[model samples]
Target chain A: DAGITQSPRHKVTETGTPVTLRCHQTENHRYMYWYRQDPGHGLRLIHYSYGVKDTDKGEVSDGYSVSRSKTEDFLLTLESATSSQTSVYFCAVLRGAYGYTFGSGTRLTVV
Target chain B: TQLLEQSPQFLSIQEGENLTVYCNSSSVFSSLQWYRQEPGEGPVLLVTVVTGGEVKKLKRLTFQFGDARKDSSLHITAAQPGDTGLYLCAGDGNAGNMLTFGGGTRLMVKP
Candidate 1:
């Protein structure tokens, strides 16, 4: 499990509301990533953090923002939740040459 | 954007059948990874191939990276019901641990 955990495994929110999902890891991996998986689209990276306070956008970063204040915590926020933004969010920690260890995942639904 | 195209988006076979999933791309990658995801869980890294034309095996599963580093494949021998899940391939082409994922292949091994 790499000690990676995501909070609020399931959430339902109304459109236009703001939502934040949290990812925590005890392994202290320097690289953290947020990805959303949907039908026909596979997993698309939304954002990633290389180190504390050093975050960068990914291929599908629109409408999504991420912050990493500490090595153990990375948060993904939706400023205005939209129906299209509803999907399963996964947080991953890079395990160097071995690859990534992912959290169980957080499923979000917007109505 | 670098894209990985996976063939046979869906597959259903009886237990003990053999199957292979392909992931191809025109762009070269430094490394490729294979992952398997089951219902209600995040993707689990299966293997990572770094050198071109490298082959690796994990029990019933075999992974291969193309000679040009532009493609990869996963072959399963005697698939079982437990093997039924979504398989994803990702390529690492950039820095900061960014990976581009292919559309997943959903496999069902009926017992």
Candidate 2:
């Protein structure tokens, strides 16, 4: 619980719908990351931001996008949700030199 | 791409039993981290190993980093029902700030 908050702890949306998840942090950490946890795949990085307005794609960024408009807020958007994208998403902030503090997580289901 | 492979996707044992989980990789990492995730919650940091051949202990849990910095192992002694959770291993592959995670080991300590 790194003072991070993810909106809509649980969400269910229809396929092809646009969905966005928000992550807000109070610590003002320099690095923030978005990851999705799925069965048999562990947690895969979707996107990460080093600083405000500075973001980069990760291993599984094809169907996802993110933005960091301010130091405390990072947003992940799915332009068109799909069944394959249903999973538990987590937001994390780097802590100290070698660890991370994660938020509670958001569970999204696309039908 | 750097990948971490974890063995024994699932483990179930009676309380008081001992267990070990391993994380292996083809790529070397600067450091490796272990986390425990409970249902509906995000992963919580358990330990971090930075030096090769390093061994650290926390009460009933012992963690060891391989001499090559390419692998790590966690051993839990007298496991309890409270220890049941999804265990994950992560490393900063390519020396990047982002982490690559293993498939994870689901442990169930039945009382």
- TM-score, chain B, each candidate: 0.98, 0.97
Model 2 per-residue lDDT tens digits across residues B22-86: 99998999999999999989999999999999999999999999999999999999999999999
Clash count, one per candidate: 0, 0
Q: Give the Cα error of residue B54 in candidate 2, in Å.
A: 0.4
Model 1 residue B85 CA deviation (Å) reads 0.6
Per-residue lDDT of candidate 2, residues A4-110 (tens digit): 99998999999999999999999889999999999999999999999999999999998899999999999999999999999999999997674898999999999
TM-score of predicted model 2?
0.98
Please, what are the lDDT tens digits per residue for candidate 1 over residues A46-97? Answer: 9999999999999899999999999999999999999999899999999887
Query: For candidate 1, what is the lDDT?
Result: 0.95
lDDT values for all models? 0.95, 0.93
The numbered model that scores best in lDDT is 1
